[model samples]
Target: TLNSDTFTVTKVYSDASSDPQVGVSLACDEGGPPVTVTDSPQTTTGLTADFTVTGWTDATQVVCTATETSVPPGYNSSGTCAAALSPAGGCTITNTLNSGTFTVTKQYSDASTDPQVEVSLACVEGGSPVTVTDSPQTTTGLTANFTVTGWTDATQVTCTATETSVPPGYSSSGTCAAALSPTGACTIVNTLNTGTFTVTKVYSDASSDPQVEVSLDCDESGSPVTVTDSPQTTTGLTADFTVTGWTDATQVTCTATETS
Candidate 1:
């Protein structure tokens, strides 16, 4: 029939008519060019058929998230959105590799004085009981060659207690050397008690011309004491007297009778 030849109304050809569009439109808003995902194979979901880039004239933003190949009903392919201006955001992916390590030595310090005594240490990477310095040893019997207490840590470290003559009751050996060390030599000390002596003279003049005597006195408690010329050595409180002569107190008299 010639009516079937009428430029078939089966598909109308008009630009402004109720007809299906035969071509895409270039009329887009002033927003963005758009993001094109050419490698995605989820084209089965017609909702993901197209994507529009919005709100960024500066640069395109991509959010990273996990997505499904076959999307379920009422669900859209989504990922975490951009929280800040960071690079990680909307519609992107990521993969992390192995990690690394960084190290820095820390100094030991105190609240007030930082680093007092020298704390020298040697150690391995991950081991206990670090190597450190040890203290000095003890000293004995080094005084003036007889008693030793302290010393310097040097060669020939000799000390002295000076007055080496060890008086009685102090020590059998003298005082230590000024520079005392552990390995000092020993010396002998005088064991006998030692002192001084003096001599005095007098007649019967009681307290006036008092006799000079380092000898033994009357007693420990006796006052206005008397002494003998022959000084005597005594042990502690012990006393002894030697009286060979004395002025006779009864021999002198005042005679009032005239003599012929």
Candidate 2:
């Protein structure tokens, strides 16, 4: 058997030829093409076929060769194929043109995806979601108001100030009160939120001891008297006076007389 570029099978005749033979025919693995029979897989460079059934056993060896046809412009590539006795036989076909690419690719964010912890004042135990924003509590002067505004659920507001600078016995859990000292320097704190509130710096000279008072008012004008106590206008006129545990702006004009 001989090879050709167009994959057509070419037959070689023996010395003892045609006229002496009783029968003569050709067969291929697949049905023969019009003129040539394709007996084996196509030619791969540098490798040979296992065996070929070219008829009678009279010839010691029937060598089958493979060849490549004219490969079009970009289609041409050098390749090799080996013969195999079984399915797992070592018949490997490799490409000659080490050109085009066969690629496999994979993409991946570096954001913080952790849970958060929120602390709030909470009006009725827990109603809606309202968080106290980050702010400072103690400011320096008088009219400077520290506003802490991050409440999503509170309607009416109430606050508290835990005395930080005073001696150990001082403790407060109420709203803020604005009281101007005789020297005109004072501190006004609004504990309307959960965290440390921001302090507004209003220029004043209130150099007084750390005495806190609680003043409850519906709004700025109402003055509903946070700590219920009557301050008889006497010795030291302070927004903070002592009657039981109450102090600060105690004379709220009486809630029953008007709206106070």
* Each prediction's RMSD to truth: 35.3, 29.3
Tens-digit per-residue lDDT, 1-260, candidate 2: 44322222321222111221111122222222222333444342322233234332222222222333322222222332222112222232222221111111100011212121111122111233222223223333222222223332122223322223321112223223211111212222222111111112222576453332323222113533233333222222133322221122232232211111
Expressed as tens digits, the lDDT of each residue in 1-260 for candidate 1 is 11100000011211122322111111111233433322333233221222232343333233212233332221222322122112322222111111111111112211112211211112111222211122111122221112211111322333222232222122233332222223333232333221222233334654443223244332222222233433544323322343211222132221111111
Given candidate 1, what's the lDDT at residue 127? 26
Q: TM-scores of all models?
A: 0.16, 0.16
Error of 1 at 2 (Å): 98
**Candidate 1 — which residues are off by over 4 angstroms?**
1-156, 159-174, 178-183, 186-193, 204-260
Q: Indicate the TM-score of model 2.
A: 0.16
lDDT of 2 at 163: 28
What local lDDT does model 2 show for residue 191?
A: 24
**lDDT at position 117, candidate 1:** 23
Candidate 2 yields a Cα-based lDDT of 0.25
